[model samples]
Target: MTQIDRTMSLVRRAVDERISQAIAERRDEWSDAGPAAAELLDAAADLLGGGKRMRAVLAAIALSATADSARREDVLSGRACAGLGAALELYQASALIHDDVIDGALTRRGLPAAHRRFATAHRGSHWLGDAEAHGRSAAILLGDLLLSAAGSELGAALAQCPQGTRAAGRAAFDAMAEEVALGQYLDVRTESLPLPDEGADHAAAGRAMEEAALAVVRRKSARYSVMHPLLIGALLGGLPPHGEGARRLAELGEATGIAFQLRDDELGVFGDPARTGKPAGDDLREGKRTVLLALAWQRCDAGGRAILRRVLANTRADPAEIAAAAAIIEECGARAAHEERIDEHAERARRALEALITAEAGLSRSATADLASVISLLTDRSA
Candidate 1:
């Protein structure tokens, strides 16, 4: 197998093993809690099972890139990589679960969303009042459970490393957790805020909207998705998390991650449901205040703006209305503008990657190449 495929395979195996262990432990501990509890654990397992494992792979690459040659193989094959990969996967699963609940998403990865699954089960069994409410509550608790498990696993993972590594890992972990939470809150708050007036200074209003949206992208997705993962791995690989090497990784990761999220925003509006596993225009229905939307609002005419305002956040919007909104976005060149922004971030990440390579910061050739591949995939992917 190619190095990238091998790395992905290793991380996937580690994550699967860790999740299975978690499920078994929970099952045994709650044996007396009945079948309902087992089902809950099963649901968590199901949600945790599917993902690109992109974060875990990034961590491994960072570790491989920085570790001493003699120790590299041992560490990559040992508990540190395994534990870190698993922890990152679990953490991502938790975030996705909570995010789906917040968005009131009905499906995830082509399957019913956690809340929707629970609601369906509730209705099927004809148990309890307010099936929808029960589903949301259950999904929230499930997300919390996974979040707790992630911390515990991460702590256990770092305990086997050196004292300095442990400290660095914990610090990065804590910072990432806090930042993402703040980002999510900001995103929710942005949804309630009024859109900029159409007659307002167009450039100034566009900048404001873009800045606010980028804030959400940076904290909510970028750092969480890339920077912290790379930092954690660098720490475990014996690079000081605050040192020059770590700083370079952070810069590259953040740039790559920003591109990744901007591409995600584009996909939400323009991607095929068959590939994305969500319906077309799902973001419009959910009224995601994305950079793409902000730019489109700035360029659209009054009628087009009215159409967007009416369709956004209106979950009941029909397909035709969604088509109208999407067409407006395309015709106004917002989609193209969004793509240009993604390209800009991608180029920034490329420059950072080149700088790191030129500095000869001890990254292995294979790992550096792998990092390059990941950056491309993240920014240019269709789904």
Candidate 2:
């Protein structure tokens, strides 16, 4: 396996081990709560069973980059780093579970989403009124449970860190959690904001849409997905969290994270189900106000705009209409523009990392290379 692959495997194992142990403890502690509680833990296990472990891998990479050479191997192999990686994974799981509920997504990672799974179980067991409602309610609590677990795990991880650095780590974690919640709220509110019609000034409307979408990306995905993880890992590695190195890593993370989300937006509408594990045109059905859609609005004629409006949020839109909307996006050069934008963000991230390494911003050479490789993989992918 490649170095990155090996690192991912190790981190995945650590994440799985941590999750299993935590869930088992919870299951035992809550046995008095009855079968309903047992089922909740089962759902958590299922949802946490598999993933790319991107956030965990990033945390490991940053720890390697910042930790002193004499202590590096020990730190990487010790419980502290493993716990931190696991904590990040659990946090990511919390976000995803809640997001799927928000999006009404039926599946995640090729399996029923948390809410859907609960609903299916409820129906199978012939439970009481409103299986779907029960599912949504349970899934929300499941997400919250995972969030609590994440905090507990982070606390365990921090206890292993030096006294001076623990507060920084905790602060970073809290900031990430708060930012993502606010970002998600912005995303929901943006979806409610009406899209401008063809008669609206194209430039102004396009700019407003793009700005709104990018705001969601910045807070909801960018810093939450990349920057905070990097900072937390760096803090664990004994680097001062607010130092020049942290600043540089934040720059790299924000740019890389934005590119990652933009690519995800592109894939959401046009990517193959087999590869992306999501139905084609799902984003259109969900009416996500992505930058790609914003750009398409800018370039589309009235006829094309009408077609988009017809299918943009219409979950019942026929497959043919969805295909036409995708076609219009491609024809009007929105897809191409979106790709160019992703490239710009990715290149900026690469440059920031290069500068960090060249100026001895504290990252080791190998760790920097690994971070670069991961950034490329994240931004340029089929899924």
Candidate 3:
């Protein structure tokens, strides 16, 4: 296997094992509490099992810059890397638990979503008041539990690292957690708010809409998924900065993450269900006000704009309407436009990657190359 694949495999193993161990310990701790603990632990484990392990992989990639060839494997297996990798994955599990609740999504990683799983149980067991309400309440608490566990995991990981490094890593993790929560609020808010007005200028209003959606992307995806993990890992890895590009990693990471999120926006609207693991046009069904929809408003005609504004976020919009919305997006050139933006940000990330690597000492060319290679996977993958 390629070095990238190998590193990812190892990190993936570390994430799984770490998360499993954490849940098992919790299970043991709550052994006297009965099946409720079992349900919560099982849900957390299931969510943790579903991700691409990309966040953990990003952490490992940052660590690679500080390790020599022989020590790379050592570093991966070290207490530090294992701790960081596991911590990052566990944190993601917490986020997904809440995200599913917010999005009202029925599935995650091809399985029933956390909230839905609970609701299904409530219905199947034929017990309780409203199944959905009970499910939502359980999910809220479960998400909170995972969030707390993630913080504990981070604290544990930091215990063995230098004080300065620990502080930096913790700062990134805490900042990201806060941003994601607020970002989710902004997303929910955007969906509830009316479209921006631009008098007779459909184009200007479209730009306004796009800006709002991009705001959600910046907080919810770019910072949360990619940038913060890079910061936390690099800080924990303790690689000193050295070149002109030394200070730009944050900007680079953010740009790279935005591109990744924009691709996700596209997939939400036009993705294949079998590959994406959610229903096709699930975004439309949920009425998510993404950049894709914003761009459609900006560029399309009045009929197209009305079509989007009318049906894009209805949640009750039908399949024919969803299909019509998708067609309008492609026809009005939003799909192409959104794709162009993804390419633009990806190119920006490439430049930033080179700069960040060049800014650091002892970063191998292959290490630089490996980090660069992940951009495509982030932006172009089907699932």
Each prediction's TM-score versus the true structure = 0.96, 0.96, 0.95
The sequence of per-residue lDDT tens digits that candidate 2 reaches over residues 160-214 is 8788888888898899999999999999899888889667898679878999999
* Number of the candidate with higher lDDT, 1 or 2: 2
Question: How many angstroms is residue 160 displaced in model 3 relative to the true structure, after the best TM-score fit?
Answer: 2.9
Ranking by lDDT: 2, 1, 3
> Where is model 1 more than 4 Å wrong at Cα?
68-74
lDDT of 2: 0.86
Give the residue spans of candidate 3 off by over 4 A.
Answer: 196-200, 240-246
Worst 10 residues of 1 by lDDT: 68-77
Candidate closer to the true structure by lDDT (higher is better), 1 or 3 = 1
| Model 3 lDDT-worst window of ten | 239-248
Global lDDT of model 1: 0.85
TM-score of model 3 relative to the true fold? 0.95
Q: Give the whole-model CA lDDT for all candidates, comma-separated.
A: 0.85, 0.86, 0.80
Q: Candidate 1 lDDT, tens digit per residue, 166-210?
A: 777788888888998999999889887887676778667877889
Collision count for each candidate, in order: 0, 0, 0
Measured with C-alpha atoms, the lDDT of residue 73 in candidate 2 is 51
Which pairs, if any, clash in model 2?
Answer: none
